[model samples]
Target chain A: MKTAQKNPPAHSVHSVHKTPTNPPDILAPVREMIQACIQCGTCTGSCPNAFAMDISPRGMWRMVIMGEDESITEELFNTKTFSLCSSCYTCTLRCPRGLPLTDAIQALKRIQTRHYPEKAKKNIHFYASFLESVRRHGRVRETEFMTLFFLSMKNPFLPFSFAPLAIRLMAKGKVKPGFPSAGNGALDPIFQKARELEASS
Target chain B: MKNFTHRYFYYPGCSLEGTAKEYDISTRSLMAALEIELTDIPDWNCCGASAAAAQGELLSLALPALNLAKAEAAAQASKSTAAWDILSPCSACYLNLKRAEAETARNPALRARVNAVLAEKDLQYKGGVQSRHLLDVLAKDIGASRVGHAVTNPLSGLQVAPYYGCQCLRPYAVFDDPEIPGTMNPLIRAAGAHVFPWNLSARCCGAAHMNTHPEVGISLVTDILKAAKGADLLVTVCPMCQINLEAYQNRASRLAEEDLHISVLYLPQLLGLAAGIAEEKLGLALNLAAEKDFRFETINEPI
Candidate 1:
């Protein structure tokens, strides 16, 4: 089940104007790499997420080669299959045409994140919030990252769903209730550096 | 051109400089005895691990490009008449460099932007250096035939998971298969250790995710540990993956409500053990596992 973001907008794949005539610089090499694909079904056939893909690896390759990037981009970013991609090189290793499929898809994700920085920003916020806890504490305190993630979300109780598990963890001595460590030097700079890097380009 | 025994350009990321000093230490000591020389990059910078990409996409590529540029310059300065093999002991560093090289090589425009960033430091990368992880260099350069001859101890009966992690194989299919990578397995076996064949061998240990999202990180580590439950030890080739899974294994195991206490050792450490290097000499003391628990004894029988 795909979970919708708090404030939703109704937009379909057709809304975006994606053309191949002159794609972004970051995307050109990707396009060329995808064009090298001979539409061999080997990737789709071997893909662990082939059944789950919005556009199968072959279809994604075809769309990329045709310069129908919006469709490809939408499928990748909006669909669960993208993240489900194991970043495994099974497809690339199997490609007889020597196309770098694994690298191309990951590169595609990086490209999409570049254009729609906000979505990437949101994911980063959720992701980095955890790192902030670790950097501040020397070691990661699960309770802290969970607390921050939930607080940032409109539905605060969403994280509580995992409370029972957390309880079990605490009982097993996997996580300590109190501060795991008493250091904060590396944490601030790590987070600050990450944020600054994100904000720059 | 000056000739040096087994000399290659080295790229050590932030972890080696700070947290994973043991990986840096052991790698240097083990490689030195094997005649593999590590020449660190001058003015080397971060490889932009999991942070750079999350912060912004451009820096993800640019940061690695900076390291690669330094390596290329060093290679040129050395004037060594060998292929430019830029060896990265860290998995994240290796992946980032390979990813940037593959991306820029594919897109000249992106290369231009990256070059613009490189211009700031007055360095230009000509795509000369081949970004290879230390594991690849061990297997490809020093073949199994050579490694077999070097083995002094065989880690027999010890079942180990050859955890490739994500960075070594992702983006660029440089060395091994991402899903079922066994590129390092044969190498381990050559040293006489039993390679534990498992599905999660190439699974993500959340890399930097453990630092950013503890829940996700814990969940990922739990799953990886669960998958690799049968193994005696989890041998890894990446520094970040090593730290996350090994350092955080107990915590992740506790979080998942299990009594999982799998040892995590570096591939080089395992190789060092097989190569007759003592466990203490290989920095096994720094490991979270019982250092004495997994030592391999040399066998008189041919493996």
Candidate 2:
């Protein structure tokens, strides 16, 4: 029932400059997938976290399909609508257009990270810390990953917010205390090759 | 001598080693009791989870591709001509692996790109390995009747709610009805527990949002917990759902202004108990809510 804001906030990330008229190449697949959207609003209706989103899923799609002014796309990116998606795929399942709505939302997140890392700073730090853990160790060590994330945030107070849960989990032996190590380093070659490929492409 | 009926390459993702260790323990114990042989995918790495997608589609695909390629190589090395199945207990890991399998199978261009990255590790995923969730294998491959036959202690009188969460069901409706998943219903019944009717089975548990955005995550958890108030325990197939539902009860209670305390357990842990595998083996003590909120004695009757 929440309504989308018509205009971007004055202090929004891209308020200084208009976004490019054409969407990024990364969004081409998503654009093709959603071009058939009839704006039935089924995605918005089925979304569990739509209330938390600034713009409804339907509204985001409408902007993409309409390919209107640069400001509209700027407003679309400015909103945390795609980031709020839980990847539940409910919206994708219910979309009458059979569009990959969830994947499109995820692509929005990728686009945010690729084109606007400054705007997606917090999300970038969070996911980077997680993947860094995986890259270092063959698997993610939760404590190590959380510590890296907290350190990356540079927010000294942030650790306290999660301290109670961490303490409880540690006390229950759910999480073991350990320093991060070069766990087998088996995945290093793959990660190196992937980075090389991505950079080249 | 026990005759093993089925063999699979087990991929216990990162969470299974830490927060959701109990899930791994219970699953291994339960599967062993059912005469299922699980071989760990040799040198398997992280699935990149929901995070890697932010880096790039290639990294996300490549991360799981490494695991899938490893499984395929392991299968070939063992000289097993039959196709291999990589069984992931964590829903996130299953989804990532399955996505890699499905994407690479249909898109040869993508397959080449992913295999190009895999060539670094001297691995090439040929797309024969099947990525499966434990629920899918249990519901379809190992039917409820077989599970029932293994139960030494019936979980009679226990009211249980099956929580499918997301990932496993959506966008892939592989085995069960995505919206109204009944795959776990027969499994729950097989353990001799009454299926507590609830509509929030396929609902989202907010996944990693609990860490990134606690307010949104706690609100969703509160709603799901509120809906599951009547059930004695909520059973989940996803490690993320299990942790989010079990870990945030106090916060969810405060947010909702109600004492929302429900024992949330992995489905395998529940079945492990019914199969009369020792509670210690099932890692029951590791569960945050199970110790304080759930009582095993209430349903500890031999059928």
Candidate 3:
């Protein structure tokens, strides 16, 4: 009888080392956790936004598992599948293999923002504008955050899309007028420290 | 009054401060009515929600860690030995803080890395703070019996569909069955209201997509409103769900080609009404749906 394969090829195709041209190292942990995925359609089925996604959640995982080649990894990042994930966690809860699929999706987002910034400019700007607001006020000042996002989009007509809702929210006193006052800056230290750590890493 | 003095450290999050101000007001009013003491976590910052996750995991974990650390510091300053229960009314905030707490507790290396970032601000999280959703505290800490006892004006004829949006239930089934959550049923019944049966209780409201991708968000909201056509009011625990369900009814109606105009109110807002708390204190006037669709006198006058 063949001996039990205790540790058959520890670093298989799935365990490719981090490289500039390869998949991001940040996703390695989540990828490892989901290595047991059986190509099941549970995640894709459970995802509420999968209907609108360019690639299904199951297909995203398939790319991650078989993503040893740089081209496959590039294709994974190029798809808008992970961007549409609303962090609903439905897929994570319903996965038969109990994989951290939601986290894996999030890792894809982070990778896109960091590695493929040119492709993810719109989303990157949106999130950056949001974080800039949080960094400044410790809490998001909605109007200012929206202004920054609209400005960063470089599309003057984009604000018109939200004009109806903005008017309604303002009418209800949900959107306060006037510039947001400076916050206590209590979060400055933490934000500064986070930036430093990210830079070093 | 029965001795049910459950104390918690409250984190109302950014939405409660702005768009969902009613949720903040009603949560406080309802908690006070129940004789629950809530100490605000001093200098609590934003939980970063889904936006920060796009930046990096460190920043995502760090933002929530800052709030958790602040809660821990406040707990220590009070010289309390008991484990801290940090209650957040926003589902997104609750999940962010809970995710950080759980991740830090499970992984020592990651904890060290986060602690290193926090140490610059003279803060450190020892995983002492237990982050909880308001629904968890309501269903688990304060039982339905106590809630029922506090109801002075029972919402007898009110048909409420309890909508438990994504974050509070999923990725952590601490208080109720994640997939088929029934925690709010007892609370609705306790308020003397009929629980409207629906399968979309735990549906995704498309969250921030309401802004980023309105079409997709409106489509999801349309499905939910279509399912909840018969209900008088859809009660929600998360501010995100409340806004998404309430703010987009007009567009959702147009999309579905039906008048899916159900009044959306926070769970605490409904509970506060049943408890005889004044509408002003509950900020019921602030609710967009309540302003148009809900009738306060219907529930106020005894059936």
Candidate 4:
């Protein structure tokens, strides 16, 4: 039922937090966005997986505004709803307050993957595997990517479930399971710098 | 300025090469027919797709910024034309590149941050090049009449639903009204196909959510296909939408208990078919469900 924040109020009814005495450069935008939230529950209600989400979007926004850092981090790790966002931008579009819900959730996801790699392994594994391929070849080598992706999983046999589909695809020549040549040299240094920034940040 | 008249740099993102090979073939074939030469962004990197930004902010901007730098260099190097337009066929790539351009243009702070990271490459994203979706180029630059004029075999009876997956329409209102984009309707009609009113044309087919949460993605795809129930097939721009709808239909059917047999076709392939290109040349035979569900036996005949 394509729903929207029918009539958002002036401010979130949830109590505001006073814990943010100081904010980092990265979190500054998050803080500004936190104030912009209307607590309309539209994001949570509109979320395709709200029932499955451990921390509803409304609850997550409330925690962010309250500066309940520890609780928010725990919720992110335990519920993994931030990881479930498909970047559909439905919440961002529907937000009467115009909060960038997708980016905020992904920012939390970055924090989650950074702090709890073990818990966020599934969420970040493909990302790691994909970047690894891109780093080496500039372009994504699907063959190399698949090998890295499946092997990274504790149970490698899981990929076999999609074998029937893969075979049909191979027959149709949709898949060329081989390492292709890397792309040009333009982005190599930028990628290295990004890696360095990620480590430092 | 993307007044793409004769030629422009094209970024055929990774999915086009792998999962959507038919899209690649059809795109190349159709571009040839249209006399549009797409210089591949030499050695283009992954546009830091749905994955990169989730991990690191700097990585997200820098990845696409590098490609823009390359396209800029190409445009500057060409003395004949000042056209510095980068056309990305994949919706994710198009959105990411456009986001990079807009982000750099809108927020000087973010632009400075991204440029600081790019300094090592002697690169700076000055944000002059125009980014456009391929459909926009075909619609605006190539013009509908020219496209219609090239059509030799009109698909007069084929009932089609144009699917515009999420990434292309969201976050920005670039080419068409995101809500009711008539971008593909004109092209489909030019090819002589029956355009059905598909309500889910702008819906998301769960995107990469299919990877993390298969059930969620499958259910979304089910809804999209179920919405396009009366149509014989669905035509889309994104490789993800096409692959997801075509490959995962049966799973969604089992889960939703509906006969979701709509074969997914790339817009280029349909245009190629209507332009009288052989099915083999345009890679229609490679479409996972097109052969099984589509009634194109007569249309597949080589002109």
Candidate 5:
């Protein structure tokens, strides 16, 4: 019996309560939800992008709970972290507290990027490349987005890498080289609107 | 005083004005027949769509906020004795306007900045008006009971996967379930069609991704269509999703090496079809339909 004494029954260590210092003016709906969170970890368990997030959804909200606004704000646009959220609402539905976690994250991201202009420019290359395709053709042709994305990234071998798959898909009538098909001639005004918005922005 | 049959502000935004002309046409026609009235927001700009939001969050909100403030002011200018609500046909427009409205209601600091930008346009948001997507308006305002009464033609054999897409149910669950939504399903069934249980119904249509990463987008789309297998069509409430899923299906299907190409129809178009409206009137010809393996023209219509 003495030889089998299991190391004092292994003491349980509780985690610290880290709350976020959020701005007072954030949406009341989101604020109420964030405040009511009991750190149940249910949200963390349900988040599809949990592994992708630097501060997982639950972790981000925990920061929000402790009033760590800046930390969560920084996490929001850290595209690799929050941008891929998919807004699937898995975390929202699973939370026993009924926290509007998805909406709260959306509010935070909007507030940060709206107040700070340069932060939004980070995804310029991706969007600009895509828009350039739309601007050239009336609509967004898949072949164009691919070519532009690779070109912008300067990955010369990208198209070649996709060639085998493209050819295979093309043989199956899956790859429509000339997309947009100039359907009913509706692409012109779409381009005009794009240009206007671009100029105004 | 009497309750009006139909009255709401209409914000078509950029897409319906151009690429999604059918969405605009059908919305106008259906609203008219339903006795619902829509007030157009004059000189409305794009709701920042995939481009601006992807650029910066502030600009994203600001752009759409400009349009919202304009709508609010238009409502203020209206002498009508009813509540002013802005109805958006395009899903992107609906999401953008709704996102800005939700954020402005939440963040006073951000609201102040939006106001600073609005000052340039001399417009302001008093938060009196609400922005809603067409599906939301249908499920809530129109009521499924009313829709059920209007089904002149029932689609007995049409198995529809009610695809809500990302913008309609996501970034905010304004008027529908975010996960496993049923707003359109009830309406679809009421219009006399079968609602297929599709897991990817609310998934992203790879919106801007189709233009940013074709391979990645094709995969995203293939996953959605695959989950929606056994459906005659993938019905959507978003113009962007409709365009992405329908216009790019052949390409996406080819890459998938599976017969994942499914016809994508707008909800209004489906309803119009069920209402005994012709294809040209419902904007059917506007869609990029895959060559169907079978036709059901002779199938008995339900009522």
Candidate 6:
């Protein structure tokens, strides 16, 4: 009888170091996380918005584990999955392998936001609006931020859907406009420094 | 009625000022009624919520670190005779501060980076502080028996489904089982209220997505309301969950094709009701669905 063929090492295929142009190092932080993914479809199954995502959590894992950074970012930039995450962390807790899926997704968001802002327009603009609000006043002014977000994301009508609730809130003496000058002196510089560090790093 | 007393440094995140004002009002009223003294950390800023972390890891760590630094300074300035635990009514603030504390402790490199950024503002984050959800404080620290004894106005008539949205129970929910949290159950029962159990208690309520993707958020909330089938109302810990569940009720009712008539109450608002605080003081009018479904009376508010 012929001897049975032995299985090769898991990383044997991806072991060769690719150049920086491939964005391999961009995902260096979650390299181990990607590899540890058993592809059990546990994450995809747990994700509430899996049906809406262009690339399911399972698909992201498969590509990332194989070091397919191009495909990963393409789907990330093209899809609204990360923004839909909500940081609920249900998948992280449910993962049998305990992969930090939430962090990995956030990492993907950070990379795309920093390097490819144009492609990641919807989510990136949302993040920018939030940061701008905080950076401007040391605290987020929700109405300002929401308005700016919708306008910047080119989805101004989005806020109109919830306008009735906003009206109710306004009537109830909630929805306080004009942010009090709380963190102006203390937090503005810190925010500027953070932006500087984020850009440099 | 028994007076359960404790001291906590309060961190009312930005949401308290705008969207979830009633949560803040109810938290204050409930804590005051419990004889729990709360010291607001002066010069507190945003916890960065979901936005900062998504932008940069350093920014995420740094933003909450600034709050911690401020909390530390306040505690030291007051020299208060209480354990310096920072109490955050906002689950997002609690999680962010807790995560900042953990990150600064574990990653020295990140801590150094954060401190360097903080140094510019004359702030420093020396990690050892504990960030606690007010619910955890009420349930674990104060104990259910005390809360039970303090219930002058038992919520016997009200059926409340305790909802633990992501922050207070996930990533690092130490008080109870993250999967099937029991912290709120005993407390809910302490107030003589019944719990409508369902798997979605610890599930995501499609949080900030209510703004970005309202459709998805509405659908998720519709599922929650569906799960909360026979309950009189859905009671929650996080502001975002409360707003999502409350604000989208009409839309959800239409979408689900079922007359989903349950109201959403902040846990504190429900507790305040049980404590006999006046409905106005508890800001009961602000809860959208609750205003529609239940009528509140000016209960016996003892001076």
Reference interface contacts recovered per candidate: 0.10, 0.82, 0.73, 0.68, 0.09, 0.73
Q: For model 2, how does the per-residue alpha-carbon lDDT over B184-214 read when each residue is reduced to its tens digit?
A: 9999999999999989999999998898878
Going through the candidates in order, their DockQ values are 0.11, 0.44, 0.52, 0.41, 0.10, 0.52
Give lDDT tens digits, candidate 3, residues B120-187.
88899998778999999999989899999999999898889999998999898889899989999999
- What C-alpha lDDT values do all the predictions have? 0.67, 0.85, 0.86, 0.78, 0.66, 0.79
TM-score of each: 0.65, 0.91, 0.92, 0.88, 0.68, 0.90
Model 5, CA-based lDDT: 0.66
Candidates arranged by DockQ, highest first: 6, 3, 2, 4, 1, 5
Question: What does the lDDT read for residue A38 in candidate 4?
Answer: 77
Cα DockQ of the candidate 3 complex: 0.52
Segments in model 4 whose C-alpha atoms lie over 4 Å from true places: A1-29, A49-52, A178-188, A198-201, B1-6, B296-303
Please say which candidate is ahead in DockQ: 2 or 4.
2
Clashing pairs in 6: none
Give the range of the ten consecutive residues with the poorest summed lDDT in model 1 chain B: B294-303
**Which of the predicted structures, 4 or 5, would earn the higher lDDT when compared with the native?**
4
Per-residue lDDT of B68 in model 1: 87
**Candidate 1 vs 5: which has more lDDT:** 1
lDDT of 5 by residue, B1-303 (tens): 125544688988656754566777778777765667788887666565665554445666776787788888877777666778889987777877887888899989778767766665567776777788899888998877776766788887778888887667765777877777888878888888788876777776666555444555666777787787788888877777876776665565567776666677788877776666766676665555523432323322110
Report RMSD for candidate 6.
Answer: 4.7
The digit string of per-residue lDDT tens for model 6 on A85-123 reads: 888888998999988898888887887777678876766
The candidate 5 chain B region of ten consecutive residues with least summed lDDT is B294-303
- Spell out the clash pairs found in candidate 3: none
lDDT at residue B265 of model 4 (Cα atoms): 90
What's the true lDDT of residue A94 in model 4? Answer: 80
Candidate 3 residue B26 C-alpha distance from true site, Å: 0.7
